[model samples]
Target: MLSGMKVGKNFWNGAEWYLTSWRSADDPSPGPYRRALDTSGLPDNIVWEGDAKTYRAGPWNGRWFSGIPEVLTYTNVMEYEMVISPRETTYSYITKPGGPLTYIVLLDTGVVRRLVWDADARAWQTYFQGPRDVCDTYRKCGAFGLCDAGAASTSFCGCLRGFSPASPAAWDSRDTSGGCRRNVKLDCGGDGATTDGFLLLRAVKLPDAHNVSVDRSTTLEECRARCLANCSCLAYAAADIRDGDVRSGCAMWTDEIVDVRYVDHGQDLYLRLAKSELPPPSSPQAFPTAPVVGGSVAVVVVIVLVLVLIVIRRRRGSTISGKLQPCLSLLSFFFFFSSFQFLRLLITAAYANIHSTLDVPGARSCALSFPCIEHQLSPAHSVTSSSAPAPIVPYVDLLTLREATGYFSESNIIGRGGFGVVYEGRIPDGRKVAVKRIIQSPLLDEGGEAFMREVEVMSKLKHGNLVQLLSYCKDGNERILVYEYMKNKSLDLYIFGEDPKLRDLLNWERRLEIIRGVAKGVAYLHGLNEEVIHRDLKPSNILLDDNWKPKIADFGTAKLFVVDQTNPTLVQTAGYTAPEYITERYLTLKCDVYSFGVMLLEIVSGRKNRNTPTLLSDAWESWNQHRITELLDSAVAQPEPELLFELDRCVQIGLLCVQQSPNDRPTICAVVTMLNNSSSQIRAPKRLVFDAMTEPRLREADHSAKEGASSTSNGSHTIYLS
Candidate 1:
């Protein structure tokens, strides 16, 4: 409230002293700049004119800033506390008994004042004034200094007893903040260990305290002992200095100290320094007494690593999966081998600096660097080593997975899917695995139960293209579903030019194989007895395995419909969506057929519909315009001529599935039968006709762009009738 900077009406949670004068009675644009308690030193409120520190309320005593005479009156209106000790000294105001006219705020403008509302007068009145003079510029002195603007010296800068300005030239120029430096560097915790000491400064502000460890129950002596023992522990203090006595609590610091100032009342801070960094001692000093210390440095590090590894290893194995370790391990091996091969080529004979030259025995050959996380997690089984094709999610005991992943860490995230993310984890025996995370995001579903549908549906169905659900966590708001990590991730990478080799790897044979796998998966979803329609299907949803097999994943939005039963409204996606569903809201197995047909064409063409001139138009042009080759992804070569025939057949099926009239499309059974047929030449589909009753302008506007831009559209429907 005191800074005079306004927070907006909407975001403000009404703390009156700031911006608002109690309520919104005043113009809140901007008030004069003013600042309050800076705890970097003995706590006090100081008003300023930009560069000049104008007012001083003095340092905080255990009860109040000693210089604030108004605080004595402050007791009449409200009981406020001004505290000082070691960890920090602070100044704050709160209401007390019978104290309705309360508010001690730093006023806007360069004035330091306390305000009290006169309820009867219906106005606020200021009772306290600060910055009586120009002597309050903090750190007015240069490095190694103290500021007493009232000083009689010709030069304002004064070096402390033993320290000097870091740059005497700069000191003359009045450059501070780069205060002082010890002429002799301290022999810090380098080498073995060294002696150090603390010099006490009385009634002064403590330096910045960041690495503080506080203990309320500990006494002053106990606090000192704690700091002396650890090489890193620098200072200690009793947080609250009260009634002219130190009270409970301790705070310790470990780094360089900066910015100390004092008021009429302030804290006593004990600082740490190496013996060399300290002043010449008046009396011989004993190494400050330390608490009992145990264990070698290495031993402690190893013990800590052991405990951390135990916890993290388990979680990593379970959540993100330890694929990172395996991945790194794999990379490390390649680097190692590549280096060795280069060395063998470069050196006369097998090199002699084997051990000394960063090379180890048997490491030069094709030896595993670090065992893959899979080997570490489970020695008996590869995370992906199911005798039968691995389930989308393997059925493993919870304990086993827990033992594998070191409990998911930042390093575990490998990939993500619509339903969840994939994490690399490791198992106990050191096997690495990937874990899929079904995240809970507000944008996808608001209520917790909406995600439960996926569990219910996936629990009963299994198919190759369908990503298998490994396990689910329903214990809390966590509606997490785990699945087998598909090593190659999704087909998007291969199809999208994100990875060039990806396309080449999936040659004609593999591409056709992926098509069939997907067809079968979507076919299963549309079967008679257990009809499941995948409402969302795309390249991102299709995951590829280590062997490049495509698996349809993320059935969270999938709908299970039965034969003869149909949805009355929109369910499937557009483009891939059956025309009947988008235009008139009628859904059938043909809906999934339509979607599957889109996916089939996508796999063969290695192109996305959203990126095309138009999926249907592209298909039509490819069929008749001699640009058939352009339809296939440029990254991948043409599939076998026989396979090209299958691609053509599938493309035709896709068109039939997307016909404007649902009745015009063949049943899924007939389509699959034709797909399964080895000798049958699928019948060509009739070009769909648009309704003519609609006004030409509306029809043209409503018509998809892909249809308009690629061709003139002046001729009759170009049907390839058989």
Candidate 2:
């Protein structure tokens, strides 16, 4: 350990490393706040007020802690680790050798700072800090409350669903320390007959671990059953969310849950609640209850009045139709006249507006027509004029791109696909980038546009497991996308390479980390404002940074599903495509899930999911024969017990992901949650839909052409073994 480090603490020095308190400038004494490594379970950095954890740097998730996703970008500058053994467990980090001069300090106040020495300025510069905002404050919202930094309100604290502020007076006065209380109490009688369920809270930091029981052997479903059986368990979450599955077991709270808040890249927490407290399911019925009730009463009154009128008319021997005919005609005439005038007035206003615009002398060149042509002609300008795009990702001039990629030299080529060729490049600022130059063809305009749209989406997306889109160039027929270069390139070359040394690099832990990263990236894509489904999610599309951390890439073939639209096209890669997607042209988030599952199994076995005699069938057979160890990659020798358990659990999840029925498949979000929570239960998948990969027609075509299905005389579709 460096200076100022204790048996339970670690430190480093480089730049101006110092911590200041939120006190009078003259006060140099320490405050209540202290930063320390939490030794419980997987180690993480936490700032505590006495014994209570006030703020956390988040637990390590392979590459970095859950909350600090930016660490992925610093792979070239830093390395972090947590050591666990029978003797002791500790968390530590170090700057990459000869990379940067940096130091970290825990302030007397509450801030944790990482600083670097600025040689030119002869001063220390702040590199990073935790508790950077009010939302970072621990338990800013009391128990069962959520803190949203982006919420549109005067206060960030809000109660979780099925819950309300514990003290209305305190809440109103902005004193949320009382926290929140459930609206309905749990109905558990210890007989498993009670009406109780769980409420899932997404993107949240797990609550304090106090008074919580942790078990690493049960699945998530089993954990829920356990919590339900106890009757005192208030909440449950996965004990180890590293693999994103319930098989890792779980943690169940038996007392008041505290210090819970939402973070950008946080874990999921399933809070136990009474069934009655659950929010009502949503429906499409738009008619109001008040209108229905009032209409019914009016109809009844009208019926009674008509009956009396008819009786009087019959007694008088008079025709009621004749009497009402004149009145009805008068009302109809008045209504028609009003409607005619309204239509005429609307038409006149529109004509006047059009005429006025046309009268302008300069407007002849401009199309000032309805469904304005100007907006369509200058979309880039219009989009920017209305609302500025994020500056983080921008458009680059063609000249700059050409200089970066040596005018698309063959020597620079790094990756190739049907849509484009990716080349390694270095920008003017000495930062490395990958430039993808699209193949231009008049018949492939849609593909080009898709590439551009993907660039737009990728620019806005920020995640550790996603390839960052830095800029783009769309000059004339040349369309190009700039990305942050990954030194390790794609995963396929490493895992399926001829070199045994290369294959061995992906040990059990590394493979699990890759799976987790890919799951996270997929989950983020699925949860976007407009859900994006990467129809092609094969290993070649998964890239790795210098540290071998995986990043999901190649969105050129992605399908963006708007709120009301659906994907009707059949598209994917061979062996990795979902059966439902190919046969019925069925599309959903589950299609990508299936591909991810296939890739996951491949990663574990170090083999490709090829045609006919498939990896899928082989693994399934091995699983059924109770010899899954036979399917393990030979590179991983003499696996430890823990590694074997993780491998088995991952294999189970992969099978679950590749289920034949899309409905039976879990969503990508669920996959991420499952990967993190070891105790989450995974249901055994049904038998897979078998395909004949060696068919004559499939053999005639290339792998890329084998994605479609053929229609039979009976109107049913058959997979092309793609």
The candidate scoring highest on lDDT is 2
Off by over 4 Å in 1: 1-411, 417-420, 426-434, 439-456, 556-575, 625-627, 688-722
Q: How much is 307 displaced in model 2, in angstroms?
A: 55
lDDT of each residue in 558-623, candidate 2, tens digit only: 443222135455445677777765654567789889999989889988888774346776776666
- Tell me the whole-model lDDT of each prediction, alpha carbons only: 0.51, 0.64
Candidate 1 lDDT for residue 629? 72
Q: Candidate 2, which ten residues in sequence have the lowest lDDT sum?
A: 713-722
The CA-based lDDT of model 1 is what? 0.51
Name the regions of candidate 2 deviating beyond 4 angstroms: 1-392, 446-452, 556-570, 691-722
> How many residue pairs clash (N, CA or C atoms closer than 3 angstroms) in each of the candidate models, in the order given?
55, 21
- Candidate 1, residue 79: Cα displacement in angstroms equals 99
